[model samples]
Target: MSRYDYRVRRKLFNRGQESSHKDFNSFERKYNQRHRIQRASRFLLILIALIVLIGIAVFAAKADNIKKKSAPLESEKELAHTKNPL
Candidate 1:
């Protein structure tokens, strides 16, 4: 006889009316539209992340190449200084 029983809630709301087929169809359409938008957003997010990662990798490779090109110049300068010894 507690006040939190299911029978009490059902009696108070009279909650046994089934929705019409048209109403159910509208709900399903809205649900499907929202699901498609969510899926597209997820795909776009992944694509953007991949692009950023590829850009970072390309930038890193360029930086490594620049460092490699500079290393020989620095060694040549050292060799010249040693030969002059002044």
Candidate 2:
């Protein structure tokens, strides 16, 4: 074959290989982006659930404290005594 024809064939093969690589690279990038979004959404859901649980625990604790504080204190002698005859 002529030198010019050989050069043209070589350049064409290189371009085809490069295009295939580009196609796979773009596919990988899109897959990674979609996976990252899913991961982010899962993390957000977990974080929100943790926050809600913490809020519920805090509210229950506060309610318990308020109830205890509102109750009248017993006398020292009464505290030591039980509901039985001496």
In lDDT terms, which candidate is top?
1
Per-residue CA lDDT of model 1 for 2-84, tens digit only, reads 67655534355335766345487789999999999999999999999999999999999998778444355778988988999
Per-candidate Cα RMSD to the true structure, in Å, reads 5.5, 11.0
Measured on C-alpha atoms, candidate 1 has an lDDT of 0.82
Q: Give TM per candidate.
A: 0.58, 0.51
**Which residue segments of model 1 deviate by more than 4 Å?**
1-11, 19-22, 67-86
Over 4 Å off, model 2: 1-22, 68-86
**Candidate models: Cα lDDT each:** 0.82, 0.78
- Give candidate 1's error at residue 59 in angstroms: 0.8
Q: Report lDDT (Cα) of residue 12, candidate 2.
A: 46
